[model samples]
Target: MLTKKNSFSILAIGAVVASSLVLFINSTKKQESALPPARPNIIFIFSDDHTAQAISAYGSKLTKTPNIDRIAKEGAILHTNVVTNSICGPSRATLLTGKYSHLNGYKLNEKVFDVNQPVFPEELQKNGYQTAWVGKMHLGSLPNGFDYLNVLPGQGHYYNPDFINSKNETVRYPGYVTNVVTKLSIDWLNQRDTSKPFFLVVGHKATHREWLPDAPDLGAYDNVNFPLPPTFYDDYTGREAAKDQDMTIDKTMRLKEDLKVHADYEKSGIFNRFTPEQKKPFYDYYENKISKEFDAKKLTGKALVEWKYQRYIKDYLSTARSLDRNIGELLDHLDKSGLAKNTVVIYASDQGFYMGEHGWFDKRFIYEESLKTPFVIRYPGVIKPGTQINELISNIDWAPTLLNLTGTTIPRGVQGESFLPLLTGKKVAWRKEAYYHYYEYPQPHHVYPHFGIRTDRYTLARFYEVKDFWELYDLKNDPQEMHNLYGSKGYEAITADLKAKLKKEIIHYKDDEALKIMESKL
Candidate 1:
């Protein structure tokens, strides 16, 4: 009953319908591919007392931090990333609030960080990002900005450390602290809300004081005899505060506790926390090998000091080895999980530490070694590979930059201006100088409370409270800060100009105590 013309017309109509459906599907696929990710994921890999001198990216001869260097090679590195306060607790507080020590009300390590205050991660949460802080957050109180919080209690032990979770339960994880922290971080990343972007602070307790390396990294740098810094025997002739300080490689760094000279494996201390399996490698390395060699030498005077320096370097670098390796592991996880394309990885330290510079170990002084910290960041699409930013940057800028990167609003009362524009190759007016203030004193290292300003070519500081003396150094000429130019006859005009700028900065920061002391000195 069907005609030949009717059947041909129906077949032609069916072919046209099929072609239209294919075009529509291809268009939708193109549209989806064109859209960029809503927000970038951020991973801030933070460490304690990791000096630029130890990071290979920062031209360090001490050690090769390949994983840390990878960040610098991929993105940008800050040449002058300075701290507002050169201590651990206050530095972390500044990173959180984007404010100085006086403004944040966390000026010392003994005090508690006020978690009720607003933080950048809180802003991220409001903007549809999942936030977490894993590892050593030494702020003395539970964190508030994070959705997932698993952190070390105090200065976390190097081996088999305990992590206080969000449930407020102290759970002991049996592994080296660095590896454990990374594993916990990876676990959080895996278990997190994958639909949303994540902001994670992977805090590490590596390379801190009493440096304890991982078991496999026991004698990593035993053969490498590190060269002493040129200013190692600094006499502290003009600097009164430097002379009175007790934190020296020659004196303060302990024999048994720091260098592990005849360290008791059976003793009830940090070692006791370690399981017998964990103690074997450490005991064998330090006691059976290092301790025996040290005892046999019976080194004295300069020889003994140099020997101690070598041991300290070996232990510290070994500790840092684990830190770097763990970083590599974390990076591998991101790459494997396909998170590398949209994740911004940042590596920085709480503060810089002296590696036998000025014959010192602790970080309290407002010198070049302690004042400046290493900051390297990798953002795959945004930041160009191998970019070097020489602009003067402060740690206070951390929060603001992170906020801006995520397209989040920087809250009011946040002092730091975002350096995000720098990453995007935009020409903007940046800070010409950086301000620094150190408050802890007398008890820990006796560095004496001080406030200072570091310009492109000069560093002007007033050591107050106990010793009301001023120290100025022309950093261009005296890179080692050996010559004090505060009261020198030839540089009166520059000194006056720097003092005026310092006063202006102190007042602008609204640090009443610093202003009062500065005014009194004037």
Candidate 2:
């Protein structure tokens, strides 16, 4: 309806409008660039062999962990935090890959971690995260997917330990292992490029096997007497697996090597690692004082078992003292440095430990004590203060949850789901049970290999590889799991249901070998 000149004029006006749109977009982008980044920094503090019963937040009458309690006080505490495997190396591997041990190829302590595999940390680094790991990383080799890494070399020493740095050089640091790890972590935070968000993992070797306390904390728990577990002298009445475990406090714990009895195992190289000044105080206390008293008592049988329990608990708690103290120190640093509000602080262990539960010390079972790990998290803006989560969570779910929190894309093939909704108090449906598998047997601890599923009120396990048997427990009725109800007449429906659920989980996890085994049994 218009003339040629009018059409030309309209086209010119359209060009101007397009040009203005481009300018507006550019201005918006510039404004976005001027705004501060929103991704929160994460500081994950991990300890080795620390049990929930040891933390005061989890109700420990033996010791109080005020510093470790801060994370829960300020954020949320997860009651049912569980791991796929209850060992050290495999647990770390699961946290890294977000996959089950069978898929990740690090099923046991003997297996070397396949470093070529994709890990969540690598994904985080690609998404503008400055990732670092300090202290114990017992994954069989130098770790991948970390910008800064200084880790212990194979079950690192508690005193004067050697750290393998990113350059693959072994550097020996003076002082207690806990202190050295803390100092190095702080140093990294100070030197890190602060423009980018960071994912700093601080690992501690405190409270591991051969619990060695720092010199200053040698007699910290001397005044307190810890009560022996009710099942300390368990006769293993109806359970076959409980009868064969070799990690009992009375039978396996070495007085000379593990308890610091001051007997000369010069070849053990434990005391040789210390200077004479260091050795002098150790002998003065253990040999001159404690050993003399032990000789005087001449305890036997149940009395001997009770005595061993006390000594073991005291030494174990003393080591944990430094760990808790250093945690407080790190939190204070975060606060003073103005990084607390934006930092997502987390506290957990490699796996839960056995504080003499079931007459055992090491964890390799699907039982409640060894299966449950402590997990507390604090995100100033995201998590409400003093929140306690009863949702079921697994270590395999850790990577996906962390990635989801940072707004990063979780790579495919991850086995875990994000629990961020649980923290935010959302009404989203969450997992009802946790899957578990333990492969180590006949070495270190003589626990048989087993796999199981733990629902909110029940646990059903199958001990395979050596024997064919099924164990089931109604957790509500028998919280201690003293009774096994695998083939009782009344439990036909529950047993069948559990078996089916476990079979489905096995298939969902792509554990083909487990699936075949389960199918054959069915």
Candidate 3:
């Protein structure tokens, strides 16, 4: 039993088994290394009233957004990111809940967002991630699902704005709103728990209504006399609601409040919120130069409207300058802090705004200018540089996409599916059309509440409430949408098809109000 050959054979078998185990361990290590990180940090920079038409990455001719364009250059840009409800609070609600406005219960501004409902950030918390929302949360209620929050009380001012912190105490921050927001966001990032990943929303208040540029940014585009849009003097031929809207540049945009004409810097208004030194640049620019020029010109009729247009464009773009600069500062911080490689940086707006489109100033209609918002994102080692997606995407899909990116389970209540596969260059089934609805009405802009559907080459909407009418446009043949083709001869089939799709989408979204309107009104 103790032969020399038998002992040697047993030893050889043991050596072979040891070698196979070592090879298996090495292979397992290699596979684990090939996988993505366990969790990636996310930084979503949301700006208010920033339209795609103002961002250079979207091929804007009026302004050059070099900083925002950096995201598109480094990763991917979406050309057709539509909002479910093209308003402020509704869009943000959809983004947070991955549901349409009706389902989220925030179809309008000036209302409390239901914090009891689940948000993506809350899901992130359960999955071992820290969440924070800093700056310009316009939702009236105190926010939940965040470990830290310092948001604007309402539509925070351009200079020396007050921030409501997590304790619900209002603290005034002394500086431009955009810069303060960025500083607060960075401060939180620096102090956050390093062991866990983070989700932060850097909300910027620049380019909102009253369009006040920062002190140094005054007169930034003085030399550039922006050309008028092709539909500058849009004659509402067949469109009844367009004719009644009060948001035209010639009518609704005020001289004293909106354009800062003849504004008293020392008076108790927006300027009074500023300190003496803070008001200096505004007074020096508007009072001494702009107001004096206006008095001398005494413009009237078309000349007056055109002058207002130029002033509005200049002020809006000038205000946006600070926003872009702050974005650069945030990007640089990420690079220096070694978070650039693992963090997902995204830039999007609440909803698009009109810059003289159809001679309008505000956004409430389901038109292209208001429906389409800007969305660009950078994900290192995942999305290749200079990727452009033209698929139909909705703001509701934003939450699900973020959840998918962090490897979290998307909740069933969330109606939108993730667009992560599209970003990763995967071929998948995608939506061919997008649904849109707008409900705010009768007060501010007087834009009629409407619901519609948009396919690749066509847009069909039915305006209700104040006025009941159907409008359809072939976006391919008439990109400007100047011609209405709803009841035109030879277009019966197109109208019926779009209406059927619109009905199907309404039922799918479970919008009972829209369904009733469709049945009774249409």
Best by TM-score: 3
Mark the regions of model 1 whose C-alpha exceeds 4 Å error after superposition.
1-37
Which ranges in model 3 have alpha carbons more than 4 Å from their true place?
Answer: 1-17, 20-27, 30-36
Residue pairs of candidate 2 with colliding backbone atoms: none
lDDT, residue 517, model 1: 87
Candidate 3 overall lDDT versus native: 0.91
- The sequence of per-residue lDDT tens digits that candidate 3 reaches over residues 257-296 is 8899988666646777888898888988998999999999
Where is the poorest 10-residue window by lDDT in model 2? 262-271
Per-candidate TM equals: 0.93, 0.93, 0.96
TM-score ranking, high to low:
3, 1, 2
What is the TM-score (0 to 1) of candidate 3?
0.96
Clashes of 2: 0
What C-alpha lDDT does candidate 2 achieve relative to the native structure? 0.89
When summed lDDT is taken over every stretch of 10 residues in candidate 3, the lowest stretch is 263-272
The sequence of per-residue lDDT tens digits that candidate 1 reaches over residues 323-430 is 999999999999999999999999999999999999998797779999999999999989999988888899989999999999898998899989989987889998
lDDT of each: 0.91, 0.89, 0.91
| Per-residue accuracy of model 2 over 1-522 as CA lDDT, tens digit each | 899999999999999999999999999999999985589999989889899989999998889999989999999999899999999999999999999999999988856789889999888888899999999989877667899999998789987889999999999998789999999999999999999999999999988988878888888988888887777767877778888889998899888887877567366666667667766777787889888888899989978878888888999999999999999999999999999989999999988888887767878899988999999999997899999899889999889989988888999989999999999888898878788988887898789988989999999998888786889999999998888898888999999999888988888888887777776753
